[model samples]
Every structure is written in C-alpha cells, then in structure tokens.
Target: MAETEESTGPPATLIDPIEMSKLDTKFREEIHSMPNGEELSACFACSTCTAACPIANIWKYKPHQLIRMILLGMRDEVLSSDEIWLCLTCFQCQERCPQKVRVTDIFFDCKNLAAEEGKVPPNIVGLGKELLEKGQLYTVTADWEREDMGLEPDVPGLSVDGLRNILKETRTSKLVDGDK
Candidate 1:
C-alpha cells in the first residue's frame, strides 16, 4: 500500500460563523427594490456567468462574485468598486445565467446608484459631459470614411437643443455637472 505524503504547509485555517447582526440587511432590500433587480436573490454562485463573461479576466469582481457581494449586503464595496463600471453591458452573463438573474441590468442599476453618489469613474464622467454638451457620444464620421463606404459625407442634423433640454431635466444633468 502506498502511504500518503505528510502536508508540508501550515495547518488549514478555519472560518468562523459570520455575525448576522453586523450585516447590512437594508442593502440587499434596496437593490431588490430597483427595476430589473428583483431577481438578485436567485444567484447561486455557480460561476457560469463568470465563465461566459468575455472580459472576466480583467474584472476584480466576477459577475457571480458581484452578485454574491450584493447578496452579502456589501453595499459600499459594490458601489465603490470599479468592477461595476467595467461591465461592457454585453448581456452575455444575463443570457447564460441558469436562473435568469438579469446580471447586466443589475449592474446598470448599481451604476446609476453609484453615479448618484458621485462614485463614477473619470472616463464615464467625461462621456456624460460630452453627451450633455454635444447630444452625441462620438463626433461626426470623417468625410473620407463616408465616401469610402459609399455613404453621404454629411449626416442628417441632430436636435442638440432638444437633447440639451432632456439632459437638463434628468438626474444625469446634476451628475454630469457635479451639482451634488
């Protein structure tokens, strides 16, 4: 009979029970109340979402782990984490979720809440500024590219004034302007 080799490393560390009273119980409830966030509790941490995510390799908190954190009521951690904004909104995780957890939608809600708290990343803030100022995220395409593609060089006009009015009426206006 072959004998098993003795362990060379330190003894296994044991985990103590989490103190339930210390958990932020309201955080999960608040998330559940948001639109498309009602199904957050259905996540079982199967890691399927993480496996399906194309950019999970770059994420500090994987999709499954983000859901787990939200379920665990780590509100400040989740809201402040750049991982929430790192999502590409591709909906791959949402499509792959066995429980249909709407992972991308939940991230959108988290982002909105984070933006309200002035926790958004600088690049995102820049994008918001551009949208509010120009009514578009990108500048008009180059004339050479349009001609190469057999398209008109000049695109139709946009309602910049209307867009500005809409932006001014929305919470995003305050967020973009740093009015908090």
Candidate 2:
C-alpha cells in the first residue's frame, strides 16, 4: 500500500540558524560602530521617513523596509535593492524622521556596500561614466538657458575638458567603471 500526504516533519532549510544569528550579531556591532547608527535603534516605526521621501512613492521597497531589513541583518536584500540607488539624497526623510535616524546617510552606506559588492545597476554605472567623461550629467546648454531668460550669454562658459580633468584628479572616475 502507498502512503499519502503527512510524511516530512518540516521542509528542508538552506539557511543555518547559527550562522544567521552570528551574522545578525556582527551587523549590529558594525552598525553601532558607525558615527550615528545608534540613532537607528530608536526608530518607532511611525513610517514618517517613508512618507516624507519623494522617491519612496515609486520605490518597490521603501525606506522603512530598508531599516527593518538592516535591523534583521538582511544584507543581501538591502545591498541588492534598487530602492537604495533611487534615493535622491535630498535628506527630506532624514529631516522628517522623528527618531533622528540618518536615513540619507544609511542609504549612502548601503550604496557603498552594494558598489563594493559590484551589485550596482548598469544604467547608473553608465551615467557615472558619462559624468566622468563629460564633466556634466546633462547636455543642457547654459547659453540656451540664458537666451531663454533674455540675458546676455556668459562668456568663458563651462569647459567639459576642464571638468573632466577635475573629476579625474578627484578620483571620481573610478565610480564609473562597472567592473569596480
């Protein structure tokens, strides 16, 4: 006779509980070591940070989720999320956070972690390259804007080469390389 249903006690698991616990402990220690991460522990989950973030409206995962993920030591999820890249760095959320959590700085930290792991999105990498090479993110002509304003076009306008050289000197060019 063939047996039916109810055989396994529980499904097999890939994650090791002990390893996960260790990682959580390490992450908490690292967060506490940061200049302002102690503020992270004060979050009351009011979600005001998310509400104040302009980019949060369009994000698949909002700021609050990122904070929760950090608290839970979900490193892979936080590092690989597109929401971190989408942050405008406007500091609106940080300004509005009742807990005084440095949301913008945390996003910067997450972005740096993702970049170190080579997980940055291709489009963003490309834009960084363009900015590095051209010394400008947009092609809007200053003269054209001046003309629209009914003002005399300024002479000795922005020099792309000079800007590019400055960026190179500042070592910002490395930010463009996708392989980095």
Over the stretch 67-169, how does candidate 2's per-residue lDDT look in tens digits?
8778878777788999998899999989999889998898887787788778889888888788887778886555767888786654346578888888776
| TM-score of each prediction | 0.82, 0.74
Count of clashing pairs, candidate 2: 0
With a 3 Å backbone cut-off (N, CA, C), the pairs that clash in candidate 2 are none
- Residue pairs whose backbone atoms clash in candidate 1: none
What lDDT does candidate 2 reach at residue 11? Answer: 61
Give the residue spans of candidate 1 off by over 4 A: 1-22, 149-152
lDDT digits (tens) for residues 16-99 of candidate 1: 555566677788888999998888898888999999999999888888888988898888889999988989899999999999
Please give the range of 10 consecutive residues that has the lowest summed lDDT in model 1: 1-10
- lDDT of each candidate versus the true structure: 0.84, 0.77
* Candidate maximizing TM-score: 1
